[model samples]
Target chain A: MGVVVPLEDDRGRGQNAVAQLQALVAKEMQAVNEFIRERMASDVPMVPELASHLINSGGKRLRPMLTIAASRLCGYNGTDHIKLAATVEFLHTATLLHDDVVDESDMRRGAKTARMLWGNQASVLVGDFLLGRAFKLMVETKSLRALEIIADAASVIAEGEVMQLAAAKDTGTTEDAYLRVIQAKTAALFAAATEIGAVISEKNGSEAAALESYGRNLGIAFQLVDDALDYGGRAASLGKNVGDDFREGKITLPVVLAFRRGNAEERAFWERTLQQGDRQEGDLEHAVDLMNKHAALEDTILRARHYGAIANDALAIFPDSPYRQALTDLVDFCINRNH
Target chain B: MGVVVPLEDDRGRGQNAVAQLQALVAKEMQAVNEFIRERMASDVPMVPELASHLINSGGKRLRPMLTIAASRLCGYNGTDHIKLAATVEFLHTATLLHDDVVDESDMRRGAKTARMLWGNQASVLVGDFLLGRAFKLMVETKSLRALEIIADAASVIAEGEVMQLAAAKDTGTTEDAYLRVIQAKTAALFAAATEIGAVISEKNGSEAAALESYGRNLGIAFQLVDDALDYGGRAASLGKNVGDDFREGKITLPVVLAFRRGNAEERAFWERTLQQGDRQEGDLEHAVDLMNKHAALEDTILRARHYGAIANDALAIFPDSPYRQALTDLVDFCINRNH
Candidate 1:
């Protein structure tokens, strides 16, 4: 089952809002766990080992939660939501495995990555196994629209990765290019997670469109917050070491904004520390200072909040329910969560 | 389109025996190529570039040819064979892209590997792209049986790679384990390629069994020849430099054979050069001499010939036709061809 954090009384009025969402998330998460375990069960040895390593690695399961929340919001009561939820989770896990290999990363979620422990060979092959398993799950849903949307999203995810690789460490990358990559790599799956629920349940055009928009905005907000955390948040808060983006020469939104608005000296700092791939011990601290001075980090936070607001607005079409409220809370949490 | 090689001419066979098989192989190859190009057309930018690079990179297209040949021999005339052929090629290319990353090799088929040219990131992602594309192609066939077969094969392939990694440089690996690894890594796709045709076309149970056996035997033979070529063949003949497997620490059939049969001193040589991971000048030559003296390469070649004969025997169920004869020629080619 999915994990849902319950709100404590000390949180005040927000406690009621959080409690309402927690109960729905808890019930849906139970179903999701059953679905994932049943689907992941295999006679093959490597399949179970590699897949379970990722599936049990304690991802927030945000994508699946989105699917469950969307399905509940549409007044649907069927087990297909579980399948759709697992499908989204599997897709996310597959990407993580591949991403770790691409980045040659040693750590993920403060633990050694699959590539680190099992080697890139196993990580890549298992990533592939998970992908095939995802498709097998989607095919079982038997909704042509679900298949088309998910498959198209997968293609976009791969294309986005290629685009990112091409654009890595390049100062010329535009905000538009960054937006396209984020939408493809992150939001495409999110859109599918919510949209597939409406699609499988045969929701009307307007309802499906609204759910998709909510998923897209929430995904954008989540990724922007993640980018910000890389530069500004603590390891305790982010569950990852800061400055990983700069080390990997990843030109994220905060850095892009800083480079755009910073003065000449600040531009030299940005070029040497981030773009030129030379960083001193205090480079991360200096970069953070520059980002604050240029208001780049603030600008990025505002953009994330904007998307979060847009996510909340998209749910206005759905009738008032605890599940719908939880969905809205999730958008807020994307910006507010430390890890 | 698939490459067409004259079979009987190399064997100095009678003209009557060669004409039918060559014509059938040519016709089937044309269909397979058309299917591949048609399926690979995509709106994704890097996808077309990456896909075409692998598809057009002068692979012998042997696996798809085997599929088409097997289907025709089983009296299948439907167009689904083309899709099956393309599916097999896509699966094969996906493995190659992944294998290059795993092996850390920079060249394939006498040209720079996709990983080398585009970097491991592109290679890994594009490999995923081809894999997803393969599934999409299979789903269009609307055959659940086809889907199940391909899915099972993909899982086995992943397991096989893991098994190899686990067993690499471990002298404890037996001939049986070696066979299992090759079966999972190589024969599963070959078996699927042939069996899917019979299942999709609704062939008789006995015919299906025969085709499956033919594919399995031919696949084993193909791999055996490849292993032998890695040890003994010249770069010009194999399209790759010699001693590649040894460099990767892969203990193939010949090495296993030599390790088992060699005396104490020869076994010590194996351990020092391969297992100990220290190779001085002429180490490869010395290993080759040891393998030759132990008759390991000859034994491997004999085993390959044995499987090739079995592949030929599996064709007894089919009526004598040009297609059947071409399938038979492929058995000979697998064992005898240098490349």
Candidate 2:
């Protein structure tokens, strides 16, 4: 969430675009928030307690907002958008819970993970409970097309996660393979979120295709920036540890690039630290220096900027509404945000 | 799935009901098995490997068979029953994967658990993949009512698990609470599986209600018997440890009954072993002795028999077809199963 918000526009205008995006969909987001709270409730106290801890913890609510903004941009005027928004948020949260358990990470979004606070058992089960709630919420929308899109996205996301796990410490992974991983893991749901928004609004023309493209590109850009930040950004600002991927020996785009460009000795270092899990005190610092020397982090951001540009262009067909403008600026915010 | 299938019927003149059930649905089960294998495929190697480890590792496919048998009972001639059957099995397998992870169980059904073999992370993500596939299968049926039934059941099951987790190690759990947990965790899916068969067949008359009743009662009986066997059944036969719940301090119907009926000193013993986790060397034997003294295991079986009777009577409205007879005997098989 704490994305870069320029005080002045690129043209030196008065106000920022993120503020405008929230301004246009602010009331709808309130409704979405209320629906989320209502659905998080359960007769079991731990269900609600664990749900609230991670949910109410400071997520940017970016995906739900995408759903909300996309629906409004498509001229949707029904209460179902609130449910869909909540559905997107719930699905995202469910994945986060499972991801923490999978990664064995203690913190997420600057708060203690449900896995850390409650234990792995509660984290796994509660994640499942939330997913079930998400499905029920999706069914309530009565949009089978929407259901198909999100469900397929979910399946693809899981497949991507499986791929990432297999490629976790292999320096030999190609850039194309890493791209496929992020595309499926990060971008599929974003595309589904926006596509479902248009589907629910009954807009199946280029409008739906356009929103899908926008979401897909934006998601890719967001993940690339996240990869860079994990290497180069501050923990307090990013709300996650710097070099978290490095610490986990996780293979991301930056790692892929650094490994490919390194010499024989550097390659040995990479293998020892990542593949063999033999890290010394200064390995993180040395790894960052190698990335910097190879311009891996910068190139990753450059790749993200390319996607962010594509995301902005995808929305050009829509008239200059505040919603469209904010979405375009949101893409820029995702690319330029240090966090 | 190594259920206590009898060698002969009550009349001692025929094959076991489980065998009969298999004979009736053998062709359809072959197709369901094919579909499950096809869906478990992924570009990622570990997805299928982990899926096969738990899924094909000797589960009896009870829930899926329930769907097939129930649909056949309703005289449905469509191919969707196959999909529904696979859907139930996928959901069941998904839950099993997650359950093994949550319980930190090293084994399941006499084989190594996916978590134990592939690690908890793979188990968790692959479980999510299977769940996504299950939903996709449900949606493909184009029966929104069927989707709604199964989705709701899944939510209830998760809620049940959360309830159980909270109630774990608390011998003070009431019988009503225990019933709720078992109903949610186990019965909900069983009811949903059978009810969806009726729903997809468009048999919404007394037939659907009867199937629902049958499934619910049968599920309760099955779970109660499982609880009894966990303490009393042999490891080789049961395919699980004898004192799993006891070691975990889990509160089941037997534990609830024994704790409520024990004298002051015996209650203290129960508290020390179950609540305080101060298990001694002979704790398992001592626990069984106390349960035997209070007739806890017998009463639990008696309760199971009551539900089993209800299950059989629920199918009486249907004509005395071979499917109906097989289902009735299957209920008996569940209640009387030693493992």
Candidate 3:
């Protein structure tokens, strides 16, 4: 007997998956847009201005997509998914506003950051507003489990930020430390986004755990790929300049891996760029070359792919469905994307 | 029928009120210390360090005291007051931590700010952590009404901060704008602190409304007194240096009143110091003299006293008890306080 493959046509699985994902995201994004606009509109004019600036500034809305997709995959056929998705997006936007202020970052996605455009004070306060708004939406959902997941995720995200602050530009930062930071700052929200869907939909404990694991692994993979692109990807492709992380003296996975694998002369080069916090002309190119020579970028990419595969495997508990296939494709996209 | 006024030594209504209020505050403070310590401690060492630096710093702890006192007067006997009181303190600490970062302030309460000690990044992230911890505590209380009140207050506080940022050094800022800002930033928390007790105690609608009114009025009075002190009060009396608001270019109530009431020559003096954001030597003293000449400081204090009276009147519906009198005294302290 011949094995039946799901994809025989060149346009079969990939096109269908992309179309489905796009449709789902478009619908969710509309809901998120409406929720944000309504919630951000206040008696004060500045409230809407500050909030709209960040919310509408071309964020990919990846976190909300996770929420909507997860809920649908769990067979939830309710409008609460929209609220949960908006809650996820609001939480993500709040963190970004606060993060830019804390990092003193002037630019994001090739535009001036909210803190730079409005002011640090506006950014910080608006961030607080978004957080509160997220909670209000959660309460409206009437799911205690959703609240628990989000509250825990928020705490972890804050912890991750603190860890990053402590570790930034520090030569002694370890791989474990870097992982912990990513888990707290990036992965926790992703986990919550997917996990809350199962929680609200009343999925069994094992299934919910599997979905959460998938999200966690996929988020780690996503961040790892993001860090890799910071070194090698084109500025236009990524919508952010190359070496921006190095400029910020952020010791991400590539830097950590390069340092671990570097020879004595390479180690000295790393020290000069990262520890001294001074980058002369051609420093970014030189650092990239060193990372390439050490094969650190390749190794990091491989690790990301490994996590992506684990994420895909975690969905085995779910029956065969187009949503599951799209989730698998998302993991692949996270690992394989050039930007 | 002679109105029987109890002697001071008799431990009657007046004496009992003082003793009970003090005992309640002391117990709440103890719990606040524990909650703050426990919540600030993280697996991330830097988190605990930065959080403790701010939380352990010498704040007056007035907000938490208000929470405790209000709860007690509302007939709360459970330990939820402990959590609520700690929640209030955490919210205040979180704001202070964020404010220091936004203000780029080096000193608060005569010591280095958390941002100054650890860097703006740590302060911002740790502040975020404290805010999340506050919500977590509120959720543990299991009262949706308490959650709603606190969440709304948090949003208002942020909105107020944003309003202040926009209005700072802008001559277009009116007294109404200042009132709105104060209500959102200062009075909302004050209202939350007092009203949460009535909410948790399950008081009648009118009783809860009265507490809310009292807290809002008291907060306004407290802030008015603070603004007055910023203009002319001695550092020894105020615990904060005078004219600090002037240096920071903050347009408070006295400044607004002075600007409106001043003549052309006086207005030029105001513009030089506030609108132009340029302060020469002796500018602080000149501003204070101008405030006095315009009677702005006196007017502000009178307004504070009026609010203080309103706060006392809110308690008229409460059963006469020693706890109620202490609350009345608190209103006086808010309006009359030098520090």
Candidate 4:
């Protein structure tokens, strides 16, 4: 019922929290992986060709693992969680494919995006195929609550992406709006992923709500760290160029904070670089300088830690067990990791 | 049914089959339309802008009308059909938005496509939003059978699109493969639309399967006639440019039939114009001439009539009623109408 390990004490465990969860759910994770492989296949050659390009790409399977882990934590032993895990993974993969097309992103998971390899049309269609498959998987579970949660998440996530598009490159975007975007776009799925685990396990309302809270906070922290990493983290682990978000003129937490705190001259710089998308050589470096000048990245990480603490506390209701402990550690990993 | 007044004698009614069904389901259709308007209205500005551009752009509401009519045909009087109808329309609209992007089409139903006005990214994202909304609607129905049918159709439709892409610009595409493409892409939704009507009514398996067969055959016939019309019908009625399929090198039934029956010189023309996509100034004219020479368009319509007969026969099990008669006449209208 208290903080298992303080957020400041994470340096003591150098072990990768995601890897730890993966090992704990290795059996269920393998089944989910196999299910994904089997379901993604189709008679249409381009479907698998375009879909597998993204599916086989190096995703961490973090969301699916969370689904499996939450169900196990609820003390339910059944095969429905496997289908739910695969369902969430399919939903995640589908959104990524559509996202690449929306952002015109050429790279993801250290590889050429499906939109790059195939055209935007293929990415959109194949992403739809994956989504359709996700719904099919959910229907097979015959748990109406699970279906409702996932379906609502799908709508919220799409709405969030649209909101992000509206907010993109606008220096006037507020921290609150950015949080809304990340919550809807990123955390909704995470919330659904873990929430469905409890729902399928027939857990009580309070426990289900706790898991949902745990996932939502963890997802927010996860996205905050990712946004922060775009400017400050190591480029290799990210599998993307540093300042990619800056170049894309994405208005994330660091940029929003920096813009809010800047003087007139710095404000003009942001307006010219981000709002106008007129980037030149060293513009990224200059933007990074501004973020440092305002301590934006550091503050963003601190904000993420606040959410991470909430996520840790949400799991406190569950009894001490390997699954609960793994989930608890996952929150710390979400806040601390660069990629 | 005795061929339902023969496909050639549909002029006797002087009433549009779609109009008859629309009048029959006016109350439910009004609810479905209002639901579409309300659901399509999202807080996201671009979501509605892109969605309404297609939704309100003069669609006949034929699919949803079918849903309402089929439910009425089963003598059940509940409001779930309104939701299911909306679900089918949302699915149809979502696919159309994506199809326009995939086809790079600039105009549809005599209007500029959403992709043409707002960019492919908007179309893709908004289409995803609509699809998410469709799944939400289906989940709200709380009918697992309906969800399973629609979800499966979504996958089949997407797979059909991928297959159509593979078949595009290929003169070697056979008639059987072409049928598979249309059956999957077009007929699957039609089948799901009508079948769900029977399903939510608690119709027995045989009755449900009969409705499915009627819809599937009607949809196939509907698409076949449209494909043939692209070659033989007047361009003004089509709301699209004549020879669109020819220009796109879509290997539909007409093109497949022409390819199968052409002499060596004509075959060379198809290979150069279709397979190589190297069309000249008069190529469309020449293509029509070849189709006329082989009577390919006529044969395509004849094939459509053949399916229409099967569709009519499929409804013989139902008692004589206005809904049954309208559906039977719909088969003839599907084959005989140019647009």
- Best-to-worst order by lDDT is 2, 4, 3, 1
Top candidate (DockQ): 2
> In model 3, how large is the Cα lDDT of residue B31?
77
Compared to the true structure, candidate 3 yields what TM-score? 0.92
Candidate 2 residue-wise lDDT, B1-339, digit = tens: 442323433523222788899989999999999999998898889999999987788878999999999999999999999999999998998898998888888777778889888998999999898888898888888888888888788778888988888888788999999999999999999999999889989998899999999999999999998898887732223333677788778889888988999999998998898888899898888888888788887789789889989998999999999999999989878866766
Give the poorly placed runs of model 3, Cα more than 4 Å off.
A1-19, A233-240, B1-20, B234-240
Q: Write the per-residue lDDT of candidate 3 for residues A121-177, one digit (tens) a residue.
A: 788888888888888788788777787688878888999988887788776678888
| Candidate lDDT (C-alpha), each | 0.77, 0.86, 0.79, 0.85
Model 1: per-residue Cα lDDT over A39-117, one tens digit each: 7765456666877787888776778877877887887787788888888898889899999999889788767898877
Docking class of 4: medium
User: What class would a CAPRI assessor give candidate 1's docking?
Assistant: acceptable
Model 3 residue B225 distance off true place after TM-score fit, in angstroms: 0.5
lDDT of 3 by residue, B62-180 (tens): 78888888888888889898888888888898898888877778788778888777888788788788888888888888877887788788888888887788788875578888888
Better of 2 and 3 by DockQ: 2
How well does each candidate superpose onto the true structure, as a TM-score? Answer: 0.88, 0.94, 0.92, 0.94
> Once model 4 is optimally superposed onto the true structure by TM-score, how far is the C-alpha of residue A37 displaced, in angstroms?
1.6
Best-matching candidate per TM-score: 4
| All DockQ scores | 0.43, 0.75, 0.62, 0.70
Candidate 2 docking: what grade? medium
Residue A128 local lDDT, model 4: 87
Q: List the residue pairs that clash in candidate 3.
A: B17-B322
Off by over 4 Å in 1: A1-22, A25-28, A38-47, A74-78, A204-207, A233-240, B1-22, B25-28, B31-35, B38-46, B73-80, B202-209, B233-240, B313-315
Best by lDDT: 2
